[model samples]
Target: MRVYPEQLGRHLTPLAQCYCLFGDDAWLIENARSQLLEAARQQGFEERISLEQDSGFNWNDLQNEWQALSLFASRRIIELTLPQAKPGADGSAMLTGLMAQPNPDLLLILRGPKLAAEQTNSKWFKTLDNAGVYVPCNTPEGQQYFRWLDGRITANRLMLDSDARQLLATLYEGNLLAAEQAVQLLALLAANRRVSAEELSQYFDDQSRFNVFQLSDALLGNQQQRVAHILAQLKAEGTALPIVLWAVFRELASLLQLKTAMVQRESLAPLWSKLRIWDKRKPLYEAALSRLSLPQIEAMLALSSTLELKLKQGGEEDWTLLTHLCLLFDASAHSALVDTRG
Candidate 1:
């Protein structure tokens, strides 16, 4: 069975014995995991929960924990976190095989960041898709985001009037984590009082208009300052270089797909929605499509390929090359577009 984050509230009642959760947005996936865990506790699975990370993961340890069950317990829950699950790797291979014949007595939950675009259509991903539930945590949009906010409000046992809800939505945009936190703060502020829209700012001063989505949008908008600011924040947030590269590559790949489909006389709108790109990213995507042709995209991809190899091979200049690569791509997009116009 497959479930979306929007359907999670009701669909979680019938969680299968195993699940594979992965997507671009981290907050949504983490939110889904929490909700599922709470539901499991309701099903009397509190004490049986076990967690594991992907790095230095011991197959024996996982198998042992999963296979063993308390004589007194009805079911065991195993939650595995894979920060990165590349295709053909040992972890990905083992998981692909395990999902083929998941343990009936155990509820195996796998969480990971979005697979690289190149790996999206891999056999392992296909296997997971075929074998069990997949909750893709791509960024929620528009009314879906409002609905998600309402769900979170209700979950936290708080009340917000219609106006208040709309205000909160506008303030936080699509930032799930920040929105949830802001609502929690509101709940605390109005512990026994009914919160209204007017009182929102009084309780919390929300000051974020450029989140990850906006940063991506800035790149598309060709706003170098905004992009630079975002990159700095990303660095401060400890975002991995590989993760940043993956996101940029994925976006570029999607644009290439959209461009190809457009040339083929197919609809690009559906692809945009399916990609779960926020409204702010539309201009960015448009700009990128205009700025980069197929050949340019291929060139950038080739550059990333070389960068990846160099990083793996190791050297003092690897860091310098990575910085240069990011700058070169950034400059290429802006300069190439300008030159085309000139």
Candidate 2:
């Protein structure tokens, strides 16, 4: 049986057999593991959860451990964390046989990064899928993510007005786990008080690690002073170049999405709720929306891709690329769009 993170909340509690969780989202996988471990404990398998990683050990040795039963406990959970699993000859043979007759009282979990279709259909993958539950954990996106964030806020007993939530949504830049942590921390920080847009902005501007959203927000708001300041702060804080590049790319993607939605006569107001754009930054988004068109935003996103490739290949001039990105967004905000598709 396949399970998504969205359905895990409901489906997990009733699971009675061996299972495997496989997904790219580390946070979701970890959370799922925690739930399973807890549930197994409640079901009187307190000492069943055993963790293993693929890097240092023989798979057969670990397999044998899962084959053994606890003297005092009726069931056991064997968690194998292999970021990338390649079954050696011995491991492959052992796993193939194990699949034929899964231990009735032992649950086996295998987790790793995302796999291509070919990899997903590999011997071990198919074996796990057939013999036990395979929960695929993909990162949430778009409206699904917003719903997740809103749910998190409510779970924390912190009320986020639509605008405040939107602000946080934008601030998180699609990193749901980080966003969740930030909200939990904020809830503790403002115990017994509701979070506001103003409060969020102050924290975002002051404490946020540099990323695409921060840079784009700085540029969009026409805060040249802040932009310079943030770039310096990022350098001081030792943020990696590629991480910053990814964030910039994410911002460019959002801008393109925002532009496309607008051109389609889609209501930008709802996007605030969908994108989790807070009230304070809605004006900034509105201004950027008012100025940029779909074509123009797409062109800049194209430029971003080119720059990203160059940066990845040890392109000697990252500062130049950064300046160019800033200038393109700046130009979009100013005067009318030039037909620069040439």
CA RMSD, predictions in order = 9.5, 9.3
- The global Cα lDDT (0 to 1) of model 2 is 0.68
Superposed model 1: Cα runs more than 4 Å off = 24-27, 42-55, 69-72, 141-143, 150-166, 187-197, 207-342
Best by TM-score: 2
Candidate 1 lDDT over 199-229, as tens digits, reads: 8867665433335555555555666654665
In the predicted model 1, the residue pairs found to clash are: 220-284
How many clashes show up in model 1?
Answer: 1
Per-residue lDDT of model 2, residues 20-68, tens digit only:
6666677778888888777767766655545555467776667667677
| Residue pairs whose backbone atoms clash in candidate 2 | 163-278, 166-276, 166-277, 166-278, 167-277, 167-278, 212-247, 212-248
